[model samples]
Target: MSYRSWCLALGLCLINGPLLAIERAWPITEGMDVVGELSHAEAAYEDTLIDVARRHQVGFEAIRRANPEVNTWIPGEGTRILLPHKFILPDARRQDIVVNLPEMRLYYFPRDESRVMSYPVSIGRMDWGTPVGTLDVIEKRENPSWTPPDSVRKAYAERGEELPRVVPPGPDNPMGDYAIRLSRPSYLIHGTNWSTGIGMRSTHGCIRMDNDDIGELYSRVSLGTSVNIVNQPIKVGWRKGLLYLEAHPPLEELEDDAKGMDEAVAKVMDAVGERDARVDWSRVRSALNEVSGVPQVVGWEADQPLTTSTSATSSARAEPPAADP
Candidate 1:
C-alpha cells in the first residue's frame, strides 16, 4: 500500500474535546514501542498555534513543525492544526517517568505497568542543557515560591531589570502550583503557569510541563520515584510486523555530532536485531528529512509484502496558510 494509504489504514485520524493529550493512558504491549494516534482538528477563530497546542496536549515546536502551513500567531478560522500526538517511545527504561529532551515530551509509567501517560514539556535551553541520566523524585511541593538563582537575577540585572528576591506563589510565579523536585536540588520536573514554554527548549536546566499536567502527575508520584531523561532524536520501534521510525529535529548543539542516514540506518539495524525484515531506505530518509516526530512504517517482515511508509504531511486536508511562524 502507498504511504498515505497506510496512514489511513493505521487510522491516524481526527479526535475532539478534553479527550486529547496525555490524559489518555496508552496500553503497553510486550515489544510494542509505538503508541497513540495522529490527530488534527480545525482551529477555532480565536486560536493560535500555541493555544491549539495547549488544548491538544502538544508542544509548540511539535505542532508548528507538523503544520508548517498554519500560522503560529493566528491560525485563522477552520485551519486544520496538526497535533503530533503519535510518538515513538524513547529508548529508555519504561518505568516511573521518562523525559525525552529532543522531543520535549515525557512518558510516565505508573506502578500498574499496563499503560503509559505522555505529556509535553519544556527543557533547558542549549547553554543550560538539562542533563541526562536516572534520578529519583526526592520531594513534592505545592504552591511553591520561586527564588531567583543568582544567575537568573544577574540576567535580569544585565537587561536593566530588577527581579524580586523571591516570587511568592501566584499567577506571576512561573513555577506554577506544583513541583516534583528531583534528587538534585538544582533540578525539578515542575508545572508552569507559563504554558508558552511547555514544548520548547526555553528553561533554566529544569523540566517544565503544563500546569494541569504536572498537577495531576504530582499526586500520582511520590518521593523516590525514578525519573530517567534521555536525548534520543531518532527512535525506531516495531508494531505488528512492520518497523517504524520517528524522528525529531536534534538539539542544535548535538546536530553537528549526527551522522544523518548512517546513524538512522544503524539504529534500525540494531532494533531489527536478528528478525528478518526488509527496509525501504528511501522512506527512512524521507522520514528523517521531515523529522515529523510521528512514526511511519519503514520496513516489514521479510515474508510479508512490504508497505512503504510515506511522510504524510496531511496535505489532503490542507489547511490554508493564514500567518507565518
Candidate 2:
C-alpha cells in the first residue's frame, strides 16, 4: 500500500499543524495495544548515529542500542540502522498524560481523540529523582525562565563558576522555549536547550523534552490535563494476535522496580489471558536484557493467522535533524 493509503487505513497521519514535531498521533485500534511501526534507515556517507536518531526523532541511546553493531560516530555510508520507534503501551491506565520514567518517554492521550502522541524525554538524575504519581498541569509558560536551585547553583559554584539565581529566558537558559508546570513543586515538563539529553537520566527532578516536540505539545495540552508518572521498564502487549515485548533500561536509581526478564515473563503470562501462546523464552530473555527499546515478538498462538511485521525501511537525511541542539 502507498503511504497515503496506509495512513488512511491506520489513522496514523501527520497532522497539518507541524511539519517536524517528534511526536506523532498514533492511532489506538480496537484490541491492538501496540502503536507505531518499526523501521530501518540507511545511513548516508556523512551520517552518524546521532544524525540518524535526530532525523528520525528518536533518542541517541535508542538508535545506538538498536544498531549495536554499527559505529556510533561513523556508521559509514549505506549502513542499515534499525529504528526502534515501535512501542508496547505500558500496562498502566491510559489517561491524559503518562510519563514512564524508566522508558524516558511520555504519552499524551488527547481528550476525545482516538490517538496518542509519544515523545522521548529526559528524567531526573540519581540525586534529584522524578517522583511517581498523578499530578496536574498547573500552569503553562512560554519562554520560561530558569531558576537554578541552591543545589544546582552550588554544584556550579563547586566547578568554580558563578551561576545566577534566576537566569532570564533566552538562548543561554537551559530551559528552552516552553514549559508546562506540574503540581509537584519545582517539577515541570519542559523543553531543553540541549536535545541530546532526551532519553537520558540527567535532569533536576523535571521532565525535559526536545524543543520542537515541546513546541508542538505545549500548545495542544491544557492546564488541567491529568499527568500520571509511572516507572514501567518492561512492557508486554499484543497486536494482531501476536505478543510482543518492549524493554527499556530501568533508571539506575530504581533498579528494584522490576526484576528484569522474570518480570517480563510474568507480564506476558498474565497478558496471555485465555490465549495459548508458544512463548519464546530465549527471545524474551535477550530482549529484556538488551533493553534496546525495540519490540520483539515473544509469543504467538499457533492457531492464529499469519500476520505481517510492520518493520519497514527508508533512508535518513545526512543533514541535521529537525530539532535545535
Query: Which candidate has the highest TM-score of all?
Result: 1
Q: Candidate 2, residues 1-325: lDDT per residue as tens digits? A: 9664565455232222222334467989777789988778787776667667777788766777788899976687899999777888877777689988877788988888888899888888898899999999999999988898898889889999999889899888788999999998689999987775577778889999989899988999998998999988888888887778888888787897778756775687787777655566666767877888888877666556544532213212111123223
Q: What does the lDDT come to for candidate 1?
A: 0.80
For model 2, name the residue pairs that clash.
none
Q: On residues 210-289, what C-alpha lDDT tens digit does candidate 1 reach at each position?
A: 88889889999988999998878899998777778988898988778666677787788888787766666767778899
Worst 10 residues of 1 by lDDT: 315-324
Stretches of model 2 off by over 4 angstroms after superposition: 1-23, 306-325
Q: What is the C-alpha local distance difference test score of each model?
A: 0.80, 0.78
